[model samples]
Target: MGTVRDILQTKGHAVYSIHPDITVFEALRVLVDKNVGALIVLDNEKVCGIFSERDYARRVIVKGRASKETLIREIMTENPISVTENDSIEDCMVKMTEKHIRHLPVMDHQDRLVGMISIGDVVKYIINEQKYIINNLEGYIKGTR
Candidate 1:
């Protein structure tokens, strides 16, 4: 019965991002330092795209481009799919499955970014919910609420 907001509360909603103009080198540093898989690429405080490790491997490493000279925007996934906070974890699971993305940025009803959720978050919540249900069932069998 927990919500995405609940999971975020335990994990923290801090998202690491960078400007589109930043060098891949700088972006890589931030990614490594933050220990995150992706970043919300910002332009004037608005999201333009997302940069992930896959993007670097595909666009820069495979293409033989120097990370130090390449811009993050060039390799980021443009116009990436997004989700809102009101959306159910089920809804997010469906979207992520269809799109094959691991991270989803949660927005408010007004479309302002609020938090981000990863596939791991969804799995954790689902697992926790199952455990809670099983415990409740055991308690019920024992004539407890």
Candidate 2:
């Protein structure tokens, strides 16, 4: 079973974040530059919320709010669902599914932000693990293991 730690190790622990006070337009620019769907929202170096493309679509575009004037904090999902490095990939998937969220912030033992994982990350890890298992099993059956 793969853990969040495994994913972080493979993906690198680089978390892009934005200040809560930034305008939605600024956040959107960062999202484009990063090529990611979501960002961890930080305030005073602490995780405060998550800002995503979904938030922009539903809150700003749909509501006719000006992206240049609207604050990210007003639309961001505050106190987002998070997981720790020790958590298994399956656990993270369940949480994301139940919460209807695509991204999850990864925290450390002291509640410090370490990295972030998306649903795509979890699915890719699982698929890789399955491929490894299948290869090993095939080798065993063929007397190659």
Candidate 3:
């Protein structure tokens, strides 16, 4: 039941982004260097698109486009779905499942990009929450208060 703001607070609001004009190869390098599965495409500090390993596989490799030659703008998912800090983690899970996406960019009230969350992040948080609930239930059953 935690919000995106809680996740950002725990994980830190570090957003990795790239320009659309960059080559897919360059973007891949950034992905590898940052150890993230996706990058937000920003133009003039505005969210424009998103590039992911899935994008590279489906858009570049499947289409026989060379990463070194293909620009990110040519393959990135334009107008990607985003979530606000106030949105609940469960809401994000539903959105991601419905959209068939693994990553989401977190935005502030002003529509400024604040962070990014992956499916792994959400799953981990939910699992931890469940563990806490179970522990509390067991403690209550034992009259441990």
Candidate 4:
């Protein structure tokens, strides 16, 4: 219904990132500290990959790799699908659905990381929009503005 810019404006652009060279164990600590589901993996201030709980469950735990010894670069999702600030929320929903991803990194016109959006964020925005429309329709029907 709205653009990524709208979402960012509502929820502030605070992106937590980690270096790819960090160990999975260290990354997990950051994840816990940040209370986030995923972290943007940056290499020399450039977005390189993403590390999430899914990566830990499927890549490290399932593969019998030690979290303390394995680096994020080894298992993080590389070249992840991204969305721009101008992209519509519906477009983001379609991309996330098609990719089966829960999170998307947002970039600006200069390709600079601006923020990250989660499936939860999109769902909440849609729900609020629907509620607003329903309220307006009810108000109009009742001649209440």
- For 1-145, candidate 3 gives per-residue lDDT tens digits of 9998888888999989999999999999999999999999999999999999999999999999999999999999999999998999999999999999999999888989999999999998899899999999999999996
- lDDT score for candidate 2 against the true structure: 0.96
Better of 1 and 4 by TM-score: 4
Best by lDDT: 2
Worst 10 residues of 2 by lDDT: 90-99
* TM-score of candidate 1 on Cα atoms, chains taken together: 0.91
- Runs in model 2 lying further than 4 Å from the true structure: none
Ranking by TM-score: 4, 2, 3, 1
Instruction: Give candidate 3 regions above 4 Å deviation.
Output: none
Question: Arrange candidates by lDDT, highest first: which order?
Answer: 2, 3, 4, 1
Question: Which is superior by TM-score, 1 or 2?
Answer: 2
lDDT of each: 0.86, 0.96, 0.96, 0.95
lDDT of 4 by residue, 25-74 (tens): 99999999999999999998889999999999999999999999999999
> What overall lDDT, based on C-alpha atoms, would model 1 receive against the true structure?
0.86
Model 1 bad stretches (over 4 Å): none
TM-score of each: 0.91, 0.98, 0.97, 0.98
Quote the lDDT for 76 in model 3: 99
